[model samples]
Target: MTIHSVPGDFHIPFDDLKVVARGLVRPECVLALDDGSLVTAHGQGGYSIISSVGEVSHHLAHCDTARKYVPNGIALAPNGKMLFADLGNQYGGIFSLDRHGHLETVLDSVDGTSLPPSNFVMVDEHDVLWFTVSTRNVPRSKSWNHHVRDGFIGVIDGDGARIVADGLGYTNEIAFSPDRRWVYVNETYAQRISRYPLTGSAAKPRLGKRETLVQLSEADLPDGLAFDVAGGLWVTCIASNKVLLVRPDRTVQVIVEDSDPAHVGRIAAGIRESSLEHADMQTPGNSRLGNVSSIAFGGRDMRTAYLGCLLDDCVRSFRSPIPGVALPHRSRRIR
Candidate 1:
């Protein structure tokens, strides 16, 4: 693999993240609901609808189709259906939640092969569904063995499903530029952000040259990503508890980092709520948040940034200085 480098020097520090809820077990994906609430996919198995007051308004588990469903990332369809990507060793697939709160399978296999461990899902303005399979291995723990490069990026639509890029190093969250000219992805195990120019029509998109935007040490693992209106990419690093903002010009800033690396790992292990020792726990720099896995921007004016934590019971949130680019298919009303 050829390494593409871009040079830029910038580091900004701001650790003012506050927890908005608690009791949410391993919330992986958190997105805004039009009715001023937030919906999240929990790692244990199911989804939770949370309110700003830190209350779990609703909760739903997997349907019979995906008995072993382990949700990772989630998105909403135009008609109010919720789409989710699940991760599991045996059978991983995409599931959907209808208005009646019923879960159903969307796709379990692409071509003739069952999905490896699905990570993130993104829907474009053209309604093309783009997702990432972190690795070909069933259990995600084996992904640490960097020797295999089976990670791939795929797109699905009415026509069918096919991989657009392969040989990635544990691909995580996938995002697109506002103009839809570039695609950004988090290569977690590689500790780098890889991007490629997106071309061709909406129905038949293609990836161009691959380039590295930001690189970090092995201590950091980039997990989820979001984009601001100005094209700045916000990345969540789970291991180091850091949030980085990468600008279009290649300059990067550390917007959030407040945790002990070793401590954060234990938190990410999905400890039971009864096992947490509040007195023994220490939060870095007095920040109220830790062990975050994903982030999404929404709320009034699109400046509210909601963070998904792997260990914590609730999502953390803060007011972003810049408004985020409204995501496609976001519902304007809640059923």
Candidate 2:
């Protein structure tokens, strides 16, 4: 397959974007369906659904309101249910929300240890559930240092929940290669993309030797990941508010950017000095993309790119020249 380079001057301008939905609380992860509907992670408790015509309705989990339920990365199950990674202050787990909004714990602990605040959750083509834990640190912010590396990935299937990989540097989002031969993940603090060879049955999956695919600059702290049909991996950076495309040949291209140069410089310096703090990761005031965290391809042709953000109350949409590789749940009907 020929992987053509994107034009050096090509970029998605802020004026070209359209708001798809509003009144959201930290719509961190977005999933676009074939019917023009979008499901995003709601910071308050559950997931919010946006209709094709721009109607917004939130289905919150029926959980205790005392402790905040911060839903980060979410996935749609084949059984017409929604699975979300709860990044709570005092607890963390993978929860399932049914059509009736009933919340149930799917997997809160692996082996016997309780999970820390989770980061992302995904369902692969085989219907297996995978999740990431950014760190075991109490504050979580402490693990933001490049020297910290306690993050890990776990899987849930017929054999039950267990950690598949560990000792990662602040793991964020994960994606599977189109052919299902490998699984790719982003190590936020490490500023790199790594992949592990996939083997074994779905119930007892094994991740082979880890291989670093792309090493990004300190300024580019990758937060989300998705793939295009042309084999280009799209990554969204947080503080920088930039979207990058890593082509099949592993060359990187800047697809869109909306960062304050001075803000990025400070972040880069902090990362290099190993002194990054919570304050340094805050969204820049001049950001136009709301500190985009994830990118998903929607629309009938899969050319409509929807951006999930941290600071914005709505999901942002722009057109993509290349269609995205349809996710396993894209065609499944939402119950």
Off by over 4 Å in 1: 1-15, 52-54, 62-66, 261-290, 332-335
Steric clash pairs (candidate 2)? none
* Weakest lDDT window of 10 consecutive positions for candidate 2: 1-10
Per-residue C-alpha lDDT of model 1 across residues 204-302, encoded as one tens digit per residue: 788888888887663466888989887788888775678778777766677777757566555433222223233323342234455578888888788
Regions of candidate 2 where Cα sits further than 4 Å from its true position: 5-8
Candidate 1 has its poorest 10 consecutive residues by lDDT at 1-10
Q: TM-score of every model?
A: 0.84, 0.95
lDDT for residue 3 in candidate 1, whole number 0-100:
20
Summarize candidate 2's per-residue lDDT along 281-332 as a digit string, tens digits: 6666588788899999989999898999988899988888888889988987
Per-candidate alpha-carbon RMSD to the true structure: 6.5, 1.6
lDDT of 2: 0.87
